[model samples]
Target chain A: GAGVSQSPRYKVAKRGQDVALRCDPISGHVSLFWYQQALGQGPEFLTYFQNEAQLDKSGLPSDRFFAERPEGSVSTLKIQRTQQEDSAVYLCASSSQAFSYNEQFFGPGTRLTVL
Target chain B: TQLLEQSPQFLSIQEGENLTVYCNSSSVFSSLQWYRQEPGEGPVLLVTVVTGGEVKKLKRLTFQFGDARKDSSLHITAAQPGDTGLYLCAGGRSGGYNKLIFGAGTRLAVHP
Candidate 1:
């Protein structure tokens, strides 16, 4: 159980509702990443955090998507005014290295269903 | 946007069969990684190839990176039912960010 852990393995939200998915990376991991995986597709980068500092968020689908990591440990991805398009799985990953080309350990992911 | 195109989006074969999945792109990558994902679970890294024209083997799986680093392939020999899952290829940039550009993935099913 040393790998990354995500909360609310499954979430159901109505359109226009707000939802927050949490991610707890492995201890001592310096790099954390969030990705969105649509049904039948691979995961696409959503955002990245390096020890509480959010470095890159170019992959965020829209301005409604926001993520924050306080104290360099747990991360929370919040979707404001949820849309039906977000009805996919949100994945969290962590790595011990500073760079991304290194190995990253992923969690089971939080599957979100927006109605 | 850099895109990775995967071939044979869905593949089905009997046990003890061989198959190959490919990921191609026009943009060059600093490194390429292969991952296998099961239902409701996150992807697990299978292999990472940094050097162009490099080939790495893991058990019955063989991964090859293109000479131009713009493509890659995964070949499974004598696959078993346990091999059934979604195979994905991801391209990483050299900027030290973990933002990965991933292919759509190849869903493989090996029947017994």
Candidate 2:
């Protein structure tokens, strides 16, 4: 319960369809991150948010991927015109501080499947 | 791009045996962390080594960071079935965004 929580544990989207995944970080966490993990591969950074501001999004694959933490507490990752290559486990993690290398707590993640 | 490489992609050992996994890289890192991930679950951080040549122990698990900060290792003494999982090593740079670069991971299977 105190850990990060992700909505829609499983998602299936057809080609060219749009999908949105939501994440609720632990209460009062200042830093939140989104990662993409393909089968048999390690989790790769997607984007990071410090409060309401998105400081880095270099890991996002393409323009079709967008993430926002409007209120700084809850964030959403939206993928438009999804492709089969986009299928992966989307994970959300949160840490206490923005600068230090604090331990991150991850959620169960949303398994996205693009057909 | 800074890359972390883990060796012995897969290891299957009988219970009570000892095994070691390694993570190597060319670029120095500010900190290195080890995590264990089970099926259908997120990874759980086991330890973080910040200082170069640092060695940390968590129960039967031991972690070492290279003096150059470019590599690290994880050793399990007397592995057990519960220790079976995907072991990952991640590196954090000193400046700019402290984004973590993860290794490919070593899948360990401890059979009883």
Candidate 3:
């Protein structure tokens, strides 16, 4: 069985540039989550999706962050006018069910550096 | 805001030694989960403790949930070098689509 996968293992961008990170959740997974992890820190929740519907976006830090899962299986996180503070590893995780009680499978994550 | 605090931010020990990592919070949670993450990789789920005072074991690792469901601990017996990684604790609330609140994490280094 395949686990969650994120693309562009590493990315470097100018401070004002926009960047998009993609995530492919495990097949048949109904719940997907996005988290941002700073260096030497724990991952912070960004958003969550149940199928194609975005259920939670309160964790997103600011209006610059946007995420969508239109097809219900794949998701993309876009950051506009990236800031130096936005530098961190973007992690994607998915679970078989929509409940948090279910164990989540995580992807390697995309490390983004804003200079 | 629900916040999880992990103690002993960093640990270094020789192989075969025993170690424990703690996660604490003032807020009660519906469930708590432990994860181990290696460099250049995402975290892998280790165990989930749902009941108050519940304990679960996985080989050399033992996980315990606090009686009030506000804390958790992970103990490793005779740890090996392979056990080295960043240990993270996450708490799940009763509602809100199962969003998780995570701790800063403890980085463990086990030298063989």
In order of appearance, the predictions have TM-scores of: 0.98, 0.98, 0.98
For candidate 2, lDDT tens digit of each residue in A1-115?
Answer: 8888998999999999999999999999989999999998899999999999999999999999999999999999999999999999999999888875688888989999999
lDDT, model 1, position A74: 94
Model 1 pairs in collision = none
Candidate 2 residue-wise lDDT, B1-112, digit = tens:
4399998899999999999999999888899999999988888889999999999999999999999999999999999999999999999877644578899899999999
Compared with the real two-chain complex, what DockQ does model 2 have? 0.66
Candidate 3 chain A weakest lDDT stretch, 10 residues: A95-104
The residue-by-residue lDDT of candidate 1 on A25-103, one tens digit each, is: 9999999999999988899999989999999898899999999999999999999999999899999999997875789
Q: lDDT, candidate 2, residue A19?
A: 97
Residue pairs with backbone overlap in model 3: none
Highest-DockQ candidate: 1
lDDT of 1 by residue, B6-79 (tens): 99999999999999999999999999999999998999999999999999999999999999999999999999
Q: Candidate 3 on A1-115: residue-level lDDT in tens?
A: 4988999999999999999999999999999999999999999999999999998899899999999999999999999999999999999999998865899899999999999
Stretches of candidate 1 exceeding 4 Å from the true structure: none
DockQ of 3: 0.79
Model 2 chain B, TM?
0.95
